[model samples]
Target: MLVSLIFKRTYRPNVNTIQWNKTIQNHQSNGNYQQALKLFQLGIEKNTFQPNSVTYLTILDICKELKSLPTVRKIHHLIDESKNLNNDDIQNNPRIRSLLMDVYIKCQDIDSAYKIFQSMNERNLIDYCAIMTGFNHQKQYEKTFELSKQIPASIKYSSPVLCTLILQACIELNKYDDGYKIHQYGKKFLPNNKIFMNELLNFYLKFHQEKQALDIFDKYQNQQTIIDYSLLMKYYNRQYQPDKTIELCYRLKNHSHIQIDHIIYVLVLQAIANGCCLHTSEQIYNQIKKSQTHMDINNALINMYGKLGNLDQAEKIFNSMSKHNIVSYNILLNLYGLYYQSDKALKTYHQMCQHGHQPDDKTYVLLLHTLSQTPNKINDVKRIFSTIEEHKRGPMVTAAMIAALIRAQLFDEVNDLLKKLPKENILFYAMKANSNETNEKFHYPISITNEQLALYDLLMSNIYTYAGLHDRLTNVDEILYENKILKDRLSYSWFERSNGKIEYFKSEQLQLKTCEHTEKLALINALDEQKNSSSPILIGKNHRTCTECHDYFKKVSLSSSQKKVYLRDSTRFHIFSNGTCSCEISS
Candidate 1:
């Protein structure tokens, strides 16, 4: 009797169209989308009730949620069949067609979505948004721009959604001029809208217009979010304004409403690392330890300690981590390389392999770098270079190998390797080597930027001066002047004092009087600022310290002041005291 009752309930008939639609709507409202879809299909198959426009719309909504492309297509076919019977007309129902386009886009069938969009005789704002957003998501930035041109001017200026989409396209296409105009439009029209305001902030940040970004941030203080603060902090860090980054972090920390997260902590740590303030870094580290524990934060801590020349602390953090990933191992390997610990780096590489982590291209490059530091490890460098797959040897890997060979004074092998590389790669190598011979011999098909040409000229001049080729150096200087590239890419250095004040000096600023190198100017300024303090002065440079600068630092270490100095360059740290440098081989 129970089985019979269940069968009767399952096969109950006489359900009208209104009852079927209500049941589907009920299931949909309750978030039972699959059940809603099944009921609709059962109602259609059983012919208990005729499916109406409402039923079709609800089913399409379900398909959109499920991302069910096959089911959507089947329903579209049924709609077409119904049109033939004059029951439902798709042409008259733009709402249904727009929904259909949205479903197709959500299903990842952009071609079908575009077809439906094209079939719309009178497209609304919704239609344009659905299609353009789809194009943008698919990375068809050009198509998005083309559609923007067709947007009716009446709605184009008023729709925040359209403005945001166009701004995103402008960013991807690098259309700075258009992006600026859009920023002005957003300011004039949609100033108070949070969505558009956030996008505008992003636009300014992308173009590196810090003043403009700050203006927007200030104007939208009430609407500001953690993401905005994070983005601004990241921008400052990228621009090497670590002090500004830390200052902003302090502001965010003091905000009474918003709470800091792990990402913000990582950015704060990164800023401290760049600033090279061991005290501030330690303070932040202690605060982080008391509050939370995250892998990214720990990794960033390791990097911070590494930059401050505290390898033992970096190692302690690494040992404390319960799990390790490729990034963790890479950071440790990089730290070892930075300190020229080739043996330890090699042991760590073996351990990484044993733990089933395959070494990537960066691993091989780091290994080569560490091995190149010691003259006796030339053979190890060659062995490691051979193990790297040919396809994986990109421009950076090849350049690293060439650098290693040059450091070992293997000029013949360097020349042979240069011969085997493609012309483009050879040009890249020439730029790094600053070889005038290579520049004059090969005519590359690619056109390098003016900035790159200026850098090439500067490095070549340096090479000429080092070799005592006065005539060649003079000729390069003439070219540099003719190109008006003076001081465009000149190096600068800065140091933080004990009282947390930062002193910056540019190489160009001191060219007229006392110092020619950035590090020298920075050192003089640091000594003047911290005359009473005998602690080691840590200075960070934007470029590598030349041999002249290195020797000068060594001499300064033995002078009357007897000041110990730590100068961090593009690659590693150089600690000078008592007329000795930490680097085994001077540049």
Candidate 2:
């Protein structure tokens, strides 16, 4: 009798909604969000007879999945029209409010989400917790605290969602004191919500507050699902606590709901790779294949072999993939480039493009970087640059190309490259975030000269040294410390180098000032004069080369600034001030 009823929950009497739900689930699982959304709407319109919050939440789920604000508002209105929200079974509609709030949060419509929270005047702690979770989702930590104040004291603070929000926000902002206070508050409501307890443990472990983190882990770690264990183990691997990571995985093996995922398996493999235990990672990967889950663990294998510098094994594993993804190509391209195998890198690029996979920004950046390593390969950089377009460029690519141009001392070309960019400088952008600096854009082409091509190689070497790219930094540093002239040229263009070294140009000489008799008269018609005096910054196509005067500016610049200041040869005017710069390059 129980078995019959257990099966009945999934049996939809309305055959249309059932079929649509299956399609919706399939589309969602594949991350084809738009298809999922349309199918949900069709189901709702065609079968309003089976309307419930589950049906509405299905619509909301599609909104969250698609991240479509306009559709989400329309779905909310549909729910209002259905008035199933007025049903006595509000208790069964566990996720309707939460999912709606989630959609609003994803849309960044925080005000709309808050308004919904305001209308829920019955003020169940779950509702309060959901609102706090919504605020946290929006990364509005201050708002999370502000709303927490409104909850009545009769309601407990350790509501599953509130504790989780506080834990997440504290870590995000690095506010240890606030984390501690909420953590202390959390133990009271710990009897229910095992998920919250695991979250707290994860936060503690994140801060390396291990004593408390593990103690909590020991008390309720068994209560967690596979996700918590995998997360805990991943954190442990990061913290170099391999023993604990293994222990958690072992404990998780018994939980019926927990099973191996590619990510967790990858984490364990990483620990093996780090400890020089390639055999162990391989053993784990082999075991993972037997779990009845379809996952390509080839990337993990490649990464392991990569660490050992065993290109043969890495390549063997890469070739074994039935269908290669962008990540697989990127990893191999990087390895070949790392060895300065320029011919190999170019060939790989051809293979990738031939396979109908357009190379992302990193692919182009990697090629340019390898080209920067050798003078012979300089043409490759020029060819690649000419293939790019401004709109497709990103900060990392722009910065890399800018440094490359500067290294070639194509002083006049910097303006063209920069005008294509959105920022005043790439350094300012890198400061705001890590590797959000995507160079995946494959557009933004530019023409490059032989001199500019040579410069790309030199600048990339400097960048590699600074980033400590290889097994040793000296491969780059030796080149840097040796090239004092290059260093000086770079410095004059910017501020003082970090090393605070200065060197005067060898060709430094004074020049005789020649004044045109009509110079003052020209200024009287200054706007007209300005048209003729537009800087050398124009693209080469716009102006013919003035070969006779090319060498004359250095002398003029030296005499004008009492040094080799930018005004003489520089394109953009730099008005130098006390010991610093304003648009500090050159005029």
Candidate 3:
């Protein structure tokens, strides 16, 4: 019972360099970065063991994980002083160079990363991917695309992630053709890659290929993250389908699979603004306020309120913000214009300038619109018009200028101005784009009369209708039918109520009854089609309202208890009531 058995214990305190390195690797792998660093320092201090390639690689990983430039510099210094790095095997490793570049990039030292990348003798796929990623992070989109092209010919194609980065560059630069080609070239790699798919969706959306964007989203909705949903929502917003954006938000919420973020909330707020759904906007606002908010949300609230004609609320939001950027000022300025508060708009413009916010083309356009509405500011309008021309504003501004000139009834001056306008100006393009002639290279000075301007206004105002009709006119039978319809409708006719049914007259009937102008006949037909409303009837015409129709609408309005009729001829707006037209423009 008292037998004692002796067991030998293996107690060895000495550890070799390989054993220490293994321990450090295990520590780093187990997420004990501090312990790993401690062990590494102890080994170097002891001087009995030297750091090896494994030790250096692990240190690089630690530097990248920490994203600390100071720690990276220390590790790089050690690498420079270490004699173990003199080994051919350790000195010639391409992976080491690539990892160094990645670490520098992660720490925001892009120049250092580029230097390391350039110093490498034999660049590999990893090196190219890392540098391109750095360029993308820095937002050097053109450089990113350019670098992608210089990948070694030996590497026939880049990886999916690299290709996605290149496509993103293309998206930022709006290189549609190049993007499409890359999409085709990389089709084999796109099936399961979310990043690639997102950039592709962006490309399609920007080019107005909504159907294509929808198809891609539908194909990948199950695999989509929150970012994907936001992309799709933004696409819908661009297309003016706010209802669809709201529907998508609901769909995302109902699934409850993805966690919502502030960015998504901002986009949803924009959608609500577009929809003018006050109730939904309030609900979303409450939700965002519960969490941290972003500046974009505040800006979007201002935009939504402004769009809904809630100027007071928009102003309150704008005033409450701690800081305001150019966009905030622009939105406020635009809202003032929308509400026809020209004085306030000019004040806001001055405020914007005072705050060092340079006005953009859109700003000038909004100012021009307000000035066009206020005829008393003709002198100010002229100065602003000249400034806009000096700035070389687009076709829209040119159109607005034409409208203002015609509104002021300066027909002779308008003709002279049109004659003097440069051949390459937007005014020329607007004239050519709206012309009925089929010549591609048609020169401008394209007829400078009131009727010409009226034709321009009508074509511009009814752009969608004109486009549809243009397409339909390619068929001979359709053209004949449309002409017949136009011919039979009377210029002064109204729809008659018969047996609880609306009876519409044809152009031929109109021609037989009275020789009213075609434009007036269309208005009559429209007013007659909606006979129950007491509000003003608004109509647009390609030419001046003939005296006959002008007299007719005035008489009708007077007899019908002073109901108003608003008409826009190419020259000016005519509001006829009580046998009087507001314009007083006698043809």
Candidate 4:
């Protein structure tokens, strides 16, 4: 009857008439925030302002909805105008006090919540619980713990709620011991309470207390949630203990029905991807498609396809999506770029943008590396409003840009980029710090520190021994090695880790090597002349020359024979004849 009175579209003089408040409370308790707000507003429009009571709270309800400070303050104005809000009422009434705190919290008015918390004349466990929850939400971690401590031992705190807070704080502080104790309290509610038990198990798992977590799981074996199965897998995955994680997944399924969520599948896929067996992961993708309950499965499919290098299948899956989200598009774009399908990569990028996904740094870097290779797009940096150096901030991306700059022969620009980097930014420097003490000579060869000599020596040696000068190569390494001036160089004991040969650096090769200095110089001259020529090229093995020979093949793009040419020798082949060959944009 009271609820009907509070709920019905009628007015009651005594606003405290439990009926009046009950109607509004019922809707709110059921999670109908919008309906509750409207009902509360309707009450305000109908009822004359009541002093110190439920009416102010109903107004607070609407304020909580808007979650805006200005509106909440206006409500506070109405709260103040009411003759009802007195020191006496706030002191005596628990409901009114709780409502005030909640409203301030919803408004994000922390100061007001604290102010009201201070004024509460009577406080109970529930009141304390409310404020503590409020503090946790506001991210006042220290205060949340401080208040938690103040709750008397006699009053049992909600184990689940307090556990959640302690779990978060412990994770942040890396204080797993205190976090362990909090897990003990969780079992108090675990016997008949499966929900609490699951949460407790999850807490243990999260804090690296896997033993306790597994114990909880085993204890509740008859009644395991999907979470138990998923977490067991994830826990092992995090520890990098893949075998055990996979073992747990199989164990749970053998005993009971384990429904795998998308997240768990993703973790499993990741676990498999990092390991050597891409083929095994392909099986999982097939299984997911065969499942009848697979409501949403595209994320896993894309990952599986990308890792397996099945571009055709991956693209089909991607293009067929009702909505190709950023993650999907990025994967497709990057996959195409990696496989050297530059045209398809640009198409995917355009498709992604048309779908409203703007390319981020990674996307631009992938395309830029490809674009940097061509004369048609030599000015990729200026086109993108970002410099190669600035965009190459990440080591991997910077590596691609480094290769591009070397290929373009932009030495000064390359040097400036290197100059901007700190000593640690250089890769070998980091390795050197952790290396054993050694004579610097083993690292650079010359005591005075010549970049060109050190690099040239390294490149020439590498080509001679391993990749070979004729290995359809780019001279980025050779050029870097040849730079004579270096600002900071490290003494790496591991420089000898690369067992390149001495034949290239051996002055004796000047005579017997496949191509002489004059041959290279002639090619360079030809290349120089053609650099200014807007000519097409077609060259082949017949017309191909050594790096020394092709130095003049700049118009070799205009090589009339085969579309491209490589200068071959006893080792490997250099890919250009007259500075013009097929593999130009980026290696």
Work out the TM-score per prediction: 0.81, 0.54, 0.53, 0.59
What does candidate 1's lDDT look like per residue over 1-587, in tens digits? 21222222322224496788899999998999999988877766655776667777888888988998888988887665555435544335778889999999999898899999998889888888888899989998888887887888777766788888888898888788887877766666545576777777788887878788898888767767888888898888766778887888778877877888888899988888878775577667777877778898989888888878788999999999998877888888887876778888888888888999988867776777777777788998898889888887865567677667766768789777776666565335444335455434333333244333433433343344446652332332333333222432235678887766566776443222222477887788788877888767888875456667878888887773466688887566787878888875543
Count of backbone clashes, every candidate in sequence: 0, 13, 11, 37
Q: How accurate locally, in lDDT, is each candidate?
A: 0.73, 0.53, 0.63, 0.50
Candidate 3 lDDT over residue span 401-432, tens digit each: 66566666665766666665566653455545
| Prediction 3 global C-alpha lDDT | 0.63
List the candidates ranked by lDDT, beginning with the highest. 1, 3, 2, 4
* C-alpha lDDT of residue 480 in model 4: 26
User: What would the TM-score be for candidate 4 when compared with the true structure?
Assistant: 0.59
1-587, model 2: which lDDT tens digit per residue? Answer: 22222222332345455556666778877888788776665544444334455556666777776788888887776554444334533323546766677678778898898887776546676667666776776678887766656767567463667667767777776778878887787777664677777778778876878888767766764465565666677777654444456555555666776676777666665554433342244456567768643224676667656543456888898877777777777777766654455677788788888888887877776677655555566667777877877678765566556665544555467557666656433232322222345533222122222222223333444444346442222222223223443322222211111121111222121221221112122112222322343221100010111222222333333433442222211111222223333222211
Top candidate on lDDT is: 1
Give RMSD (Å) of candidate 4 vs. truth.
14.9
| Rank list by TM-score | 1, 4, 2, 3
Which ranges of candidate 4 are over 4 A from the true structure? 1-47, 65-68, 80-87, 90-92, 107-115, 118-123, 127-143, 155-158, 191-207, 239-245, 255-257, 292-296, 337-343, 360-378, 385-586
Number of residue pairs clashing in candidate 3, backbone atoms closer than 3 angstroms, sequence gap of 3 or more or interchain: 11
Q: For this target, which candidate reaches the highest TM-score against the unseen true structure?
A: 1
